[model samples]
Target: MAASRMYLSAKRAAALDAELMSSGGFSLDQLMELAGLSCAQAVYKSHPPESKRNVLIIAGPGNNGGDGLVAARHLKLFGYNPIVYYPKRPNKDLYNRLVTQLSNLKVSFTDDIDMAITETDQILDAIFGFSFQPPIRDPFVHVIGLLELTKKPVTSVDIPSSWDVDSGPPKTGELGAGFVPDVLVSLTAPKPAAKFFKGTHFLGGRFVSKEIAEKWGFSLPNYPGVDQVVELPVDNEKL
Candidate 1:
């Protein structure tokens, strides 16, 4: 259980992300699309539109945000109304393209977080990723703290926002890391922090080929058929 075969450290997760682009022959958009689709599928399976139709996706400024945008697009196509709240939008070309795609789909980008939180049935936390460091800053901190107060179910992308990738959630009762999302979607492979996550955990992003898995020293879970995401049986005690 302590091996890298199941749980990846922060360093290892970053290395695998780079290797996917470099040696794995995946372009940035390609990977983000795959990840985003998987995230959307996971959400559909976990919380169907009948259960929760309106979703509020809180995106950040990096690749994680790009993934959230992609998911929002897919979720809209899946018959769910998705409203995106991107506080710190990055000026990258890829991000611009993603936003344009979602905008074209008529997905709402709300400026009112409080209103969105009140009306939305669920929240997708994409405010941080594996490379995130401590001391959550600016609008992100305030937004994460807001999530902690919301009763709406949360589905975190990759790792929960503002959490340590390797060590899991903060123990000091930090406002930024206090919330435990109801659903967690682990991309590529489960990170070490996933062991601390108590929810309906899922393994999304089925883009990791067997070669890449072997190279990264993490065992990929069996994804049945053409499924984009697989629900992982998480036993925290064994983890």
Candidate 2:
């Protein structure tokens, strides 16, 4: 069930971007930061404290990857070594701050996806984020294959790569056959994409809603619903 009337949809998420640019006076970077920090808090709360555990963040080429990169930095600060894996070289917008942070921390980098996969204790699926529709192609399929092969504890930064945010898992094709996370660390509000699309058997697990988040005690300074980080705003434009 949609938590609130304000929940966001794919179309609405995009429109909100436009709305903010035109009226909200908020920059894309600021919004991205909000997403990143929120995601970090979700991660901290969902997983048990494991200073000895290693986390690998799979980054794509978009803003989603940028969110993962920010989380990686914070995860490191929280006492875990987070290694970020970029399938392709990240974009310039991401490179600006990402590179500086990595350089200062001198975080290890690897273009060879195979090598990075073997180095982590846990996996963070920052690969395709919300943009992924399903049936991953070529290189991505191969990378996700490695992740499945590892069978490590996996946590998606937002939504699992290519797993549709709504309509459950992709059933027709092999693009997103068996890609589910042990936990989904959502940002801002509950992603309809995350909630609706996560019921398939291939997903390999159940969802942990913001309500569950509250049970686990994930709270932040600027979070909308402190005790429970409610679902994303609904796509009212459609109604």
TM-scores for the candidates: 0.94, 0.73
Best by lDDT: 1
Tens-place lDDT per residue, model 2, 1-239, is 23232334565545545655566576767666666655555556555447335778787777788877777776777767777777676548555777578658856666777877676777777777655665566678888777656767677765677666655455654555566666665554334555443321011102223453343333322334442233233223321
RMSD of each: 1.9, 7.8
Residue 16 of candidate 2: its Cα lDDT? 45
How do the residues 10-41 of candidate 1 rate in per-residue lDDT, one tens digit apiece?
89888788888998899989988998999999
| Clashing residue pairs found in predicted model 1 | none
Model 2 lDDT at residue 94? 51
- On TM-score, the leading prediction is 1
* Deviation from truth (RMSD, Å), model 2: 7.8
Q: lDDT at 17 for candidate 2? A: 55
Q: Candidate 1: minimum summed lDDT over ten consecutive residues — where?
A: 1-10
